[model samples]
Target: MSIQKIALVGNPNSGKSSVFNQLTGLNQHVGNYPGVTVDKKTGSFPGKEGGKIKVIDLPGIYSIYPKSEDERVVFEILKDKGHKNYPDLCVVVVDVTNLERNLLLFTQLHDLKIPTILVVNMVDLLEGEGISVDLEKLSELLGGVPVIPMNARKGEGIEALKNAIYDFNQTTWTPFLKQYATHDHGLKHLPSPSEQIEDTDRRFKKITQILKFCVKRAEPSKSRKLISNRIDKVVTHPIWGYAIFLFILLLIFQAIYELASVPMDLIDNVFLLLSQGTRDALPPGVFTDLIAEGIVPGIGGIVIFVPQIVLLFAFIAILEETGYMSRVVFIMDRLMRPFGLNGKSVVPLISGVACAIPAIMATRTIDQWKDRLITIMVTPLTSCSARLPVYTLLIALVVPDKSVWGFMNLQGLVLLGMYLLGFAAAFLAAIIFKLIIRSRQKSFLIMEMPTYKIPRWSNVGITLWEKTKVFVWEAGRVIMAISIILWVLASYGPPNRIEKAVSAIPIPENVADDAKMSYEEQVSSVKLENSWIGLLGKQLEPAIAPLGYDWQVGIALITSFAAREVFVSSMATIYSVGEDFEDEATMLQRMRQEVNPRTGQSVYNLASGLSLMVFYAFAMQCMSTLAIVKRETKSWKWPLLQLVYMTTLAYIGAFITYNLLQ
Candidate 1:
């Protein structure tokens, strides 16, 4: 069967992605566009007579004459004829309730002369507002393009939309191009205009003509204005809004801790069983130990947080769907202005909870270069899910397992404080950056406050599932690979090293069996300081020693750069090698019991625990974030700078904390 490509394009909050998801269902793959951080979501659908259709969801934009980096990406892709993966058909999704504003992009697409099918989404919203669009007249005015009115959320008009796509032909849509040229002469030129006036004028003329002919409203959307005003009163108020936002944030953090515990415990126990079963089934050997202790536990460390990650995404998706996120941006914009950020930066900064890479990528929405750069630089300060395992484990070890104020978990509050510290750091850095780089360009915030809609459970579920799955698969691959490598590194030693040492030491005859032990047994039975890993660990002991880390902690630190969560796995791998511990909790308890050989003091006291948490909180410890920064900035300069600066800060902070506590 032939493969036909369809691209979904729409303004932000126009239900473009919802339409894509409804049509494609579970058949989508998300990855970066060939050379950009802009997400490329492609999916397949069964076409008429068994033909296959490929659909691409382009980033939302206001116009083809782009303003922000993300909007420019949409224009770049649509205009580049030489680009691979060009769309064969363009499905321009417009919210029927806001046709005048939504049709701006549709008219731009028609000017591009792409095979266009107009999808008037949110038709259900029109009738409720006492507004109605004449489909036939609108279709005729749009130059004979197939116009399908769809309620994308309810699956209404989807079959007709699919048929429209299957029957799409460029030849049938030339009149729309002709009409645009005749009515909006600014669009007719030999090549794309160079000056800002010419470009903006052209887009404005084209959109104005489209709205004049095709759109009619019963009355201005009073509800949109009224609800926006009402919500804005409480949410964007200088005093109350900030307080409410903080309370909401705290509630989410507390809930994440409380709700995720049961599922996390179940996952931990399941993995423990798997490891124990592997150990019991296999012969007592190095390979068996690697599988049971290193690989299983290492992978399990990342997998256990899937529940929490999903919950985070779920809350975010619901906020977005309900149009509350826009209010958040509006409320925070005034406050963020002093910090060289706009309201839009709130989305990316909040998204940093999932991962800094995507959050940094999302900064493309910021129009100003200085604002975008500062946002990208400081977004990593927001605590990501990768930090959760480390924070959870350390908090459990230090904070008592009890609640305060009859509602807040003490450990959860500590976790909440860590997140707040990250936010505080981001704000401080942004303020400093703003002061250092002064630009006088006035960028106004023009955001569309969409009508609040009830949260669609299916949509929210799909979003949460997709995000959590990506986190698991991407992070899991790196963790599992690193675990195997670490296992090998810690397993073997120089030849005759153990035997020679044993021979040199005088032993009683009654303990001959202990002396004649096998190589694996001797390696496992020996103290870590006498092993190869221990030697390497000791070599770095001097460097991190002032930061309250022993050689073993230094080893974990070195390995954790692969990912922040790997700290837990590294500790598990190191501790599980010769011990009989069955699970992570037991292993953590054993670590706390460990004493420094020279000082005869506990290894993981309050000082060391605080230092480690501070280090992870500040350090650029994830290779994934670095790789993404390199990809986005297209230079080693930024990521390298990020790594160096963050690592220095982490070192200084850890050093201070350690010394003060000691």
Candidate 2:
């Protein structure tokens, strides 16, 4: 038998994704939807008859009628039968707890004549809630559609769902719902805004009649829903909520510093050894130099940060899975509104901590144009994971590692403060945009809060794996390419410039071995100063001098425009080129020893290190983010304005920081 396609659709928080995960395990990949930048997730599994079953998990929506980009994508695919992604069958997943609201989209699918299996998820909550559902009766009422009760978190009903898909033809078919059946169900025939409201009322009336006979309920214990409400009372408390969130952030940063140190050290040492080993194993030439000095250390600079990145993602996944993130959004809505945003803007802002690309893409969910545009403009101000490596490196260089306040690591405290600073800057920028931008549409938030439950470890693990993979794979490619290019520019100079600079270094004939090695080092440094990249950095030096940055720092500032995280790799590539790799000193040790020849001061002193950190915190350094902003807004004006304002902010902030500390 040929392979068949099945799509999983549901309202937000309806456990649809859990069902998809249960069915497809690790056989999935994420890509963009056709002709759009929205994510498309597809996976496949073997069926009972040994045929393949492909599954596409569409974006969650409340109705078939389009209101947002996500809904429009879903609507386009489902309404067109000839569309390549049009599924052979559809599985409308629903939360057993919120059946009526979730079924709104299912009825629309039914009326459109798409074969669908209604998967009633989270059925395990039924007994505890003193509710009973008759699966057979519900199926009969729904025109003989297959209704499967599932606990997707525990992998229940997966086999039954697969069985239904395999034998869908054997099931009886019935006429569409009488009211919606009158139309041809084509794109041009879609009901207007007012007509949609009336049709929705009719669908609900019919759904309520079906539920009245098939569902029986009784008053149950106050342990679940009541407990959730009680917890929310404290967690969403205006005063306590912000405090709790800050405490959580402090703990997370401390864990990142404490727990990840061992592995990060191990990775650093391994890569150092790899670079040294490659140099020893290969013949001396440009190829060997590129591998050891350029590619190895560059890739290592990024890979070493993986441990910290994993912990960050793990915490985010746990928060989302335990249903606390929604409450966060709820609590933040009031604070967000005054700044020309609502609760919905909170997701993109918080998600920006992961990456600005998807965070900007997430704005598709916000319906108001002015609000979405403002959200996109400020989202990048949130210090993302890309900034973590830079922050940690600079913090280690300047801040003491000792504990403050009896237990809190000072370094972790500084990291938290940086994140808080980013949040403050974002809010301040939102205020400015609010004043400048005009909009008549009033913004509001209507969201559902899910009952709190222990996070599913399987789901958390999957999220960790996917997020880490993307960070490494996407970042590694850019870092590797830049590393090689930088190595070339740093290793070789224009014509005879490098040779003349090196030959000009003077040495005594009867010098000691130490003095001879010193002469060699001096010659290397002089040659590097005249290299192609060096000349470029020198050209930028005058512009950045007031910010306490040298030509070397200027080089990194330039290369890192490709990506924020590449700053570390760029530094690694710059320092490693035209230098001895056999030394036992680590990268940090090398950086510590660097000094300004003219001033005779440590290059990475407190003033400069802190200044650099502040610069990265506010800079518009990532080209990917700029391109995404242009795509999302469909105009160069917003992104261009964003780049100018942010760059100016970074320069002024760095200058003030450097001058104050000096």
Candidate 3:
């Protein structure tokens, strides 16, 4: 037999992704479908007789009938046989508890005459809910389409599901909707989306009739929803709910600060030694300088923060897998509605903590045009993982590492404060946009609360792996290139200008041996100040001077336009070029000891460090985020305005912070 292609279709929170994960394990690939931003997941697994079956995990939707562009893309791919991702067989996974609602999608697929299998999932919850399914009878009712009862989390029924996939064929079958299936193939003849509601009502009526015979329900001995409802009383409490969320945020930040310090220090020292060793092992030349100063330390600058980032992603993944994040959305809706944000806006806003790009993409679910535009414009204000390094670096530089009340890490408290500030800024910005932008659509929050369960560790592991891979690979390339370019600019200058400046620095005629080394250091500093990057930084210094930043900080502000994390790497490469790599001092130490030549004061003092942190908190420093905004809004006008407004806000915020601290 030929290799079979299968598609997994289901409603949200139906354990469809879990089924895909169980089947594909580590063989999955994530990509976008042609001409759209929606993710397309494909993987291969062994079928019966050791043949391979290709599986596509389509995005979750309630139905195939299009109500939005994303839904349209998914609908076309499923309905069109000529489409590249069209499958030979379709697997509809459904939550047995909510079978009526989920079966709507399955019935639509069935009536399309697609060779399909029905996977009745989450059967483990059946006993708790006092429900049972007559699997053989249900298959007989659907004209003998294969039905596999499954508990995907525990890997149960996977073998049976595989067998059903291989056994599927286009037999003469009775569709759930007979009349619609006969003339129109279920939905092909609908004049427009305005009429889908009538057809949907008819399908639900038939589904209600079918469920009456093939399913049984009674008062539960112990309802799982009862336990969940009890938990929700405390979790969704108006006051305590927000308190618990804040407490959780506190613990996550504290863990990040307390646990990551040792690993971060280790990484910092390892790179220092590696840079020194590279210099020692290779001939003293420009290539050696480039490797020892540019590439190694640049990548290390971002890599040192990976431990903290991993901890953040892990906590988020675990929260999501446990179904608590939905509660967060449910509670936050009340708080957000006043700010002109839909309850659905909470998902993208919360997701923005990881990265703004996907978070912006997540806004596609918001139905209101004005709300989505506002969310896109303000989401970058959230403190994403890209800003974590910048925050941790500055906080460490200015805030003393100690306990507040002998329990809380003072530094972690500061870090949490930065995130809180991001949310506040986003909300305040949303209010302003609400006043300025007009829309006729009324907002509402409609969502499902899944029964809470112990988090699936396999899901958490995969999340960490994918997030880490993207962070390293995407950020690494930009940092490496910028570092190389900065190194060349800092290492060389116009003609003999660098040589003339260095040669002009006179060694004291009767200097002590120790002071001779100091004289050589002065010459190196003179050479660096005359180099190309230094001149560029010097030109920018005047514009940024009121914010308490020096020329070096100005250079970082400029390069950070590529990505927020590049700020740290920019500093690392800049300092590495003019310093002695053989010293045991790490980049953080050098930053601490950095002094202004003119003022005779530390460069990264509290006022300047705090100013820099505030600048980063509000700045639109990411080009990729801008490109995505343009694509999502379908115009250059909004992104350009976003860049202008955010940059202006950052400057004013930083100025006030610096002056007040001083």
Candidate 4:
């Protein structure tokens, strides 16, 4: 059966993505358009009478005339009829509260004449302010195009939308192409007086006329505006805004620590049992050992952190949905300008806390090259989700879980401080880059503040699911592959080194053959320390010893450079390769017990944990991030400089932290 193609387009924050998620459910996945960095999301669902409809969620843009790379993608895909993914029908989502501004794009799409449906989103928001749009009249004004009032976040109007889709007649409007005419046939044709007015003025005039025809609103009372302004006065005040932003961050981390502990402990135990069960049921062999020791532990290290990941992203989504994040952006922009960044840089900088990869891609929307490049260069300094596993593990080892000052969790406070340290480092680095780099272009932050409302839980849930799933799969693949490789390298050594090491251990007097478990553990540990991977770690021991890391940590450092989250997996394999699996202790417990050979002290002390945290906070480790930086900058000079500068900062920071904390 053939599937009909439909495209969804809208200005930013028009609920376009919410609508897409509502229609497609779990069927959609995001990919990039061919030869572009902008996201191209497509999905399909069953339609009326055994038919299927495919939907494309295009990048949000304000107009067909592009101002940024992402906007250019929208123009190319919509205007180029021969483009592979061009839509047969277009659904233009319009934010009804901002009707006049949104209609400008809808009007442009109408001129292009691609069988359009106007999705008047956020209708639920209008009634409270005594504003309304006559849907039938709006449709008539658009040449009888279908108009659907929707609250996509609540699943309202979905059935009507589906019915409209089933009843759609693509042939009703012939595809009009003359408005974008590029040819100059019979070119001498003269000046028509109508063409004298600027195109922008004409679009604005049409939008105002349409508003008179269909829209109705009550002007807000002076008192209401005054109250909002008063609230903004404090919320966006220079000192108060920064204080509120910091307080909110602290509150979020505190809640994550308090609420997520029970579930995280449950997940940790479940994985422990799964690993132990594999050892008990399966016949003892290399494959059994691999499954029980390496793969299970590697995956567990990441899986155990799911609760934290979910809570972190859920809070972020809530802030955005409520329109508070935009206020923070405005506040941050005021603080950022001195460092050569503006409020627009806050979006990517905040997103970097989730993951540096897509956060870097997000910089494409920043119109100024200099500001965009500065954001891209220093973004990795902001701790990401990949760092969460490592931070929580180490924090547990050193920082007590007890309450401090009668209300705060000590560990949570440390977590908040660590995140702030990353931000501080990013700003300082930006300032340094600002002093070094030269630019003559000026950019302004043009942002619209949406009306504040309670967060839609449905939208928050969808965002949490998408982000957590992406984190797991992206980290899982790299971890599993590296875990298997690490097991092989740790288990066997050159030319019977394993056999020679085993045979060389002297038998203890009065030791029964059946009671030789301790002896066997000793032999295994010795064999692993002499294995190929161990030797490599030892080679780097001299450089890292000053920073409180041993050979095993040295190995994890190298492996995790491929991806920061791989540090957990690498440690899982490194520690589990020659250890007992039925002990029921989580990886954190095992790490806490690890001893430093030279001093006979615990390896993960307050000093070493803090040192490691500082190292990751400032380091450039992820290869995928660097490759993306190269692609985005279109130059190796930037990424190479990034690698060098970040590594230097990491080493010095780690050195200072270890010495001071110790």
Candidate 5:
């Protein structure tokens, strides 16, 4: 067999991914099927014989008749004999507890004439649930297809599974095409999709016949079902479910604030020391400034937030691994329906709180184009981790670092409020987009609620690791480039003005005797004020000054288009290079004392801090998010709409906040 292919196909919650992981341990590659958001996972391992077995893990689906684009991928490859992905062997994973529903998809693959083996997964739950399946009889009913019962999670029967694959591959079973061609109806492939109904009905009748001959059942206890249902009583209840969900979100945000703060501070201090060391150790030049100010602080900006990203992804992973994310989807479905989104959309929306790129990718699970587009468009409204550093910096500057009512950290509460604000904005904007977009297709929420179990620690760690890599590399490149450009812009100026501006900062007699800012400080200020970025910041100042921001804040606004977190690094670089250093002060400290020339007051007072925070809270600043949106929508229109609506909201919200606070 030359590169024999095995495609893992099963219904949702059938433990197919676990089985794939077991079969191809530590040898997997994840990529997207060209031009689609659906993930394609392929891996290989040595077989019982001297050959290598290539495994393809396709997305979970209920049928080969393709309800979504994701499902269509399954049908396209399986139906085309010459397609590269047409599997030489199909491993159909079946959830032993929910074997009936899983068998439906398996039967579809059988009718489509694909060589297949049935892997009865999660059989460990069978003994506990008082159920048993006869593998021999099941194989006999399906024309003697190989059947292997295994608990994929514990690696039980993995050796048996490998042996079965080796045997099956050696003598691959020819599909039972007569089952479809000889049906009394004499049905063949129909050109229209609706024509599959009669064929599906025939398949169901055959499935019932197979179950009668090959399956045995005992009355199982209702305790497991009751446990889930009872929990749903509060969690899925219309009125209370919303309350519980809000409480859960609050807990997540509170943890982000309480847990991630220490690491963030430590990272900040380390970067400052490194910068100082570079300046002290090396000769002053363009290279030294680039290393000390540009690259170091740029990298520091992203790595500083890793702790928060990990915590966010960890919580989401555990929720998904425990099967609670499905309940979140079910409950939020009702809340989302009026906004013209499916309950399944809750996944993407919630994921957006971590990052919109993956969140938008998560929308692949949404079958309807209209609902998925709406979800993608509004997901960015949910403040992601990129905005966390910006939120933290601004909140610390404006909100006092004290507890409210001796219980809550006032800053943490404000942080939570900002997140909630982001979510609310997303919800409201989704409603507006819903009204504008037109689609004849219906929306649905057909999701499987996998049995709740203790989250597998290995799976959770893997999830955290993968997501962190994406965050670091994807966001890291943009930040590093933007930081370098920003430093150059802030460092140099037109020769005539660069020199004259330094001389024009008239050192008062009081400045030599009793001035608050030294002559050196004034010169540093004028130098920045005349630099390329400063010139641009001044040109844009009239527009942002309405929000009580000066030209310096305006510069941050421009550079942060690459990412929201770049605001932190931009400010760090700008202030570090713009101010004369006595003792190294943190970004917040320097921001606090920096005065406005016109008003002679602190540039970052409560009004401007809140204004800046609100601006970032609603802005569309991530280029990657826009690119993904363009890919998903297959057009620039929706992403453009998102950019316009979100940027408008940011401006309006910031304007109101500044004037109101002032």
Candidate 6:
């Protein structure tokens, strides 16, 4: 009844997580290993009447020897006794469908000499494919260690596996012993070992001999070959594969805009109603204004994108699960070779849609230093969810609310265009960077193409929910804080002067029922020229004038660098002061009508709108991205270079667009 710990380890795409989910159910917590960003998942199950079992879901790794950073973490944890926790038992999850390759990792675990269980998962696929694994013989050959066959998807053989874990005893199953372990067969032979080394070596040899005896494959099934041939015909064709990939990407963008619009609208209206209700229920004061205007609007801006974020992640998960992502890497590799990037960079580039920070961090998988650096440099140009708000607002401002081809919304098309622009910029930048930074080695691509399977809806749902939750929570906090500060900055004016100026404005007798004055008239009566924010805006006017932006636009440009979405909240906070704008949309509408005192023309002309969009499209506007870049690169060099390069590009782009329009 001693507390026993079990660790689940497996190859990527081996359904190791499915096994963990089956064993642990909902009683689990996912976190990071101490001092590392790699995910650590743990859960406990009742063993006997009162005894309990602890299960740890280790990160999926291809080999214990370790090549990538994530894979190295697994090796370090298993090898180093100094690590906080050690498992009493290791459950090596093997894909029965791909046993030869999967067993490579299993042999490594056996060498560790931890009490072990081999879970041959996906047994259901064996019969249909004319492959059969002899379970009893396999168990007997592997020194009597339990070998359970399971179809994790259908909940088959789970009880037996649980029972095996509960009753597991090292003495009950004789350790397998043989010469030439599968993984170590190609390596140089080691000298005769001491007692501890000899014991571990015997265990590994036994596991290997058992694997060779028990595992059987029907002579090279033609299914994989046939599927690969058919897929390669179109997907890896010189021309068609690239075209198809681009088309699929366009389809994803279209789906994100059209499918998520209904839910986004629903969220927008709900938050708006909630804000109005709060205003009516609360006593009138600065507190009410602050809550209703600053906090609510700021947070609402981020919440509105939840539906879109979910849809994006859902689509990405589906792509990854179906194994099409590998083909994408295959196709992109050919296309990216000229740009000096490996094909695998496609994963991080695709992930940049969620956020650049994680996408940049994902470059750890790329082995080449030059490729990794170039990917990190240009990844920000991929339109992240943070940019979605800016694109949404600007597209709404400019594009007509009409549909084309009876399906595509005009606004959606514009949004799609912006995404394409970002993609094009990233590709071009990669090409330029490749040409500039010379590397000696010609890196070759080698990617495992996993078998295609229908995506699990449950997995997709959980992934979408978790990712959207993080976006809402992290972005929500920043927006709320900025909104409150902006509200205060805009609401309070210069010392005494503005208040005296407001009192001096004459009221005509004809409209002398001052309480009945329209919200517009009340705002117009205020001496906004003397207000602190107004003065600050005016001072920035000269600096922004070349870009066709007025002082108010300058204020928005300054605040937006904290986060692109904050531009909308900053404008809302600015416009709400001295005016009774009912909502964010009204604030935008009012902004369009405001005239420049110097030019006697509308402040938001076509030139300024174009300038604003161009600026946001290229700016390093997310603080989260900067922090993540710093952490991932472990140096200020890359992040600082990103900040300088992106800001310079944004300025030049905006300046050119503004000058052309003017």
How many residue pairs clash in each candidate at the backbone level?
0, 0, 0, 0, 0, 4
lDDT of 5 by residue, 66-109 (tens): 76778878877787778888888889999998877788889877
The sequence of per-residue lDDT tens digits that candidate 6 reaches over residues 1-662 is: 25378889998778888787777766676666776556778888887657778998988887776668888778776775455556877888898877766876776666555578899998877864658778899867665668888977656888988888778777643323434333331223323437435654554565556667766667655776687679878877889988887777777878877888798788777766767777788998988888876777667766776777777788888988787888888877877877777677887888887788778867888889888888988999888888887777666565677888987777777777777777777888889888877888667777777767788776676566567766777777777888887777766776887778667766455654444464335554364556666778889999888887888887778788898878877776676555554433554476766777777877777677768888888889888788877777789988898899889888888899889987
Model 4 segments more than 4 A misplaced: 1-3, 170-197, 221-227, 512-518
Q: Which parts of model 3 have CA positions greater than 4 angstroms off?
A: 47-52, 183-191, 223-225, 508-513
For model 3, name the residue pairs that clash: none
Candidate 2, residues 178-256, lDDT tens digits: the string is 7655555445566889999998998898889989999999886677768877899999999999888888889999999
lDDT of each: 0.78, 0.88, 0.88, 0.84, 0.82, 0.75
| lDDT of prediction 3 | 0.88
Worst 10 residues of 1 by lDDT: 182-191
After superposing all C-alphas onto the true structure, candidate 4 shows an RMSD in angstroms of 3.3
Instruction: Please state the error at residue 434 of candidate 2 in Å.
Output: 0.7
Q: Considering only N, C-alpha and C atoms within 3 Å, which residue pairs clash in candidate 2?
A: none
**Which pairs of residues collide in model 1?**
none
Deviating ranges (above 4 Å) for candidate 6: 1-5, 21-31, 41-55, 153-160, 172-212, 219-228, 504-509, 512-533, 578-607
Best by TM-score: 2
Q: How well is each residue in 1-662 modelled by candidate 4, as lDDT tens digits?
A: 12388899999989898899899987777878776667778888797877778999998888767768887788777776677777877889999888888887887677665667889999887766568788999787667888999998888988888778778864444212334354332122322445524555677887788789788888755665687788788888999888988999989999988898999899888888988899899999999999988898889888888899899999999999988898988888888888888568898899999989888989998888889999999999999988888888788889988999999999999999889999999999999998888799888898888767688887788778778888888889999999988888888778877788778888667578655766866786788788898888889999999999889899999999989888888887787887776666678777887899897878999999999999988999999899989989999999999999999999999999999987
- Structure candidate 5, residue pairs in collision: none
Candidate 4 lands at a TM-score of 0.94
Model 5: ten consecutive residues of lowest lDDT:
182-191
Relative to the unseen true structure, what is the C-alpha lDDT of residue 128 in candidate 6, on a scale of 0 to 100? Answer: 48
Q: Per-residue lDDT tens digits of candidate 1, residues 1-662?
A: 13388889998889998998898987888998776788989898998878679999998888877666777677777776555766887899988777777776787777676778889889878755767777887878777878998888878888999887766655544534343454332233334556645655665676567667655667656766687578778876889988997888788878888899899888878877888888889999978988987898788777777777777788889888888888888877888877778667887898898789899999888777777777888889889988988888787666687989998888778888888888888898788777876787656677877777898787887787688878888888888888888777666556766556545554445656556444424445454555677678889999998887889888889899988988888877777666554434555566776777756778887787888888888899988888888876778987898888889878988899889998
All models, RMSD in angstroms? 3.9, 1.5, 1.7, 3.3, 3.5, 4.6
Against the hidden reference, what TM-scores do the models get?
A: 0.90, 0.98, 0.97, 0.94, 0.91, 0.87
